[model samples]
Structures are given as structure tokens and as C-alpha cells.
Target: MKSFRLDELEAERAANDGAYLQFLRERNMSVGLYALDAGESDRQQPHGQDEVYFVVSGRASITVGTETTEVARGGVVYVPAGVPHKFHHISEDLRVLVVFSPPES
Candidate 1:
């Protein structure tokens, strides 16, 4: 068994490019935390594995493929493998939990 605290993880910066912290990795899946400050743009690329996003705080407009939708805290979004997706129009600090199935390369 394993556990993690977001606050603690946020204090540790794994990369300098963005507030993206990949916290867990198992044989079948992986988990990560992603955050963006208000007005910041998301520059993530499409993944090779299916993904699920769970909003932990704030609001934003998420674009998947050719569709865009507004999502906020407690909202969940799913993206299929190889589908293009990004977050924009961040109205508040955005924090989200990202999950990838079958692990990610």
C-alpha cells in the first residue's frame, strides 16, 4: 500500500517546465498531479495511453479533439489514447489529478 499528500508533493519540484508531479507508478497504471496558475496556458501533448483527469481545484476550459468544455472543481474528464487535449482559459488556480491506464511511456 502507498499514500501521498498533495501539499507535500507540491513542495518537491520534479521538473522546471511546469507544476507536474508524477507520484505513483504501478504495473498497470500511473498517477500524477498537474497544476497551472491563473491565466497560465497548458502545453501538454497527447498521450499514448488512456487518461482520466480529476479536478482538485479551480476552473478552466478543456479542449479535447475539436470540442471544448468548461470544467471546475470536482469535475472529471476522460481522454482516449492519442487524442489531443489541453486546458485553457484558466479562471482560477488549476490543480488536477491525472491517471493513466496501462501505464505511460
Candidate 2:
């Protein structure tokens, strides 16, 4: 078993409006910590595996396949494999845990 502190991961530098850290990954799954500074919206990506997002702090707007949900602290979202999703219009200082199964390439 492996464990880590979320704050230690490399902060992903951005020219855009958010920051993230790809903190931990294993053979079957990967985990990340994400933060949105400002103007964070309209992010659409096709995922290769099932995903679970747990809000560590702050708020988020998560979208999956035409459905949208507003998630706040302690909120969680489950996205199935091959589903297209996005994080939209989030202006709050957000810290979220993103887990992906069968680790993407």
C-alpha cells in the first residue's frame, strides 16, 4: 500500500485559470489533486477509465454526458469509463480528489 500527502505533489503551472497535481498513481489507478484559481470552465475530455471525484474543499461544476451537477465540499461524483466529461464555470478555490481506474496512458 502507498500513501501520500496531497500538498506535496508538483503544482501544475498554468497559463490558464487553474492548477493541478498528479499526485499518485499505481498499476490500476491514478489520483490527482486539482485547484481552480479563476476562469476555470469548459473543460471537456474523453476519459479512458472510470473516474471518481471527491471534493476535498470548495466548489465545482462537473458535467458528464449532458448532465451537470454542482459539487461542493464533501461532494462526490462517479464517472463511468469512456464517458466524456468536463469541469465548467468554477470560480471558487477548489481542491478535489480525482481518481481514475485502469490508469490512463
Local accuracy of candidate 2 as per-residue lDDT tens digits, 17-101: 3465666778999887767644666454788889888887777688888899998889999999888888776767677788989
**If candidate 2 were superposed on the true structure by all CA atoms, what would the RMSD be?**
3.0
Give residue 98's lDDT in candidate 2 (0 to 100). 84
lDDT score for residue 21 of model 1: 80
Steric collisions counted per model: 0, 0
- Quick one: best lDDT, which candidate? 1
lDDT of each: 0.90, 0.75
Estimate candidate 2's alpha-carbon lDDT, on a 0 to 1 scale. Answer: 0.75
Q: Which residue pairs show collisions in model 2?
A: none
Q: 37 in model 1: Cα distance from truth in Å? A: 0.8
lDDT of 1: 0.90
Q: Which ranges of candidate 2 are over 4 A from the true structure?
A: 10-18, 42-44
